[model samples]
Target: MKTMLFSILAALLLFVPNAAAHTYISETTPQDGSTVTENVQQVVLTFEGKIEEGSTFKVIAADGTAYTPQSITLVDGVLTGTFEPALPNETYTVKWDTISQDGHPLSGEFGFTVNAPVEEQVIEKEEESTEQEAAPSVESTQQANDEDAEKSTSPLLLVGGLLVIIIIVSIVALAKRKKA
Candidate 1:
């Protein structure tokens, strides 16, 4: 009887490590903090281990609207979720929660930005082509350039001023710490 008990204990110990394996995010589409030019129709995430059922995926717009799909499917460690109506231009946060095969709960969030769409880019290119054909006189061209320069100066100054202020604050903080 003691021998049977020892054998059972050894078998259980061998299986414990395999059941406790951790699942992690292996890859993600649109990558964290990246800007995508194309309209996003779906979001894909690959995991290192099998994802269990009852997983949740969400895409939240900058305006705080959450986009949840009807269902999330996990196949061969890859999770695919399709968004209805597609995603528009904005900064979006993708949040996911799932249980790994080991029964561990995993959750994480990532952000990405969507820029102008393909159609808008094509239209802008056509407009630029027409503008170049109807080139303005030298005087008007110079005036437009001057206006653009004036419009761009204020923002540049603001950014530069902010950088200078940050540097000054950093130096003062470090000097006080040194004196102490």
Candidate 2:
């Protein structure tokens, strides 16, 4: 019984950490619900875990324009989808089915809006104003964080489950040995 418990605990420790590192979007480049005046060049997704190459990231505008960047990069654990000039003021829905470091394909999206055209604002405030505006509101961003937590913690549950399975198998073996 003691040996079986030890084995179960060992399995939990071994498998739980990787499950905690499952793929999730750490942050979005534009962030949630930010009104922008200029056209965005790309949508960058910084993932918590390493993503497999050749996975797809996309932006679908409220205007029904599905813009996909021809190029993708997974450098230093960030997945970037470089786009051309963005669509007009509208909500953008980003989606992806990327392979996680643990070899699972994860997919989700958060929203952002380009409120103003960037060109006119830049032309008007062309004072080279580098003023960093106040941070965007964050109520919506919480959903993305929730997704991250969900991905990272799923492995813990898996570990717990595997531990139970091992414990059961071990108990059965011990019972059989005692009977014999």
Best by TM-score: 2
Report the lDDT tens digits of candidate 1 across residue range 24-67: 67667767677877656677777777988887789999999988
Off by over 4 Å in 1: 1-20, 118-180
- Candidate lDDT scores, in order, read 0.66, 0.68
RMSD of each: 22.2, 6.7
Q: What C-alpha lDDT does candidate 2 achieve relative to the native structure?
A: 0.68
Question: Any idea what lDDT model 1 has?
Answer: 0.66
TM-scores for the candidates: 0.55, 0.60
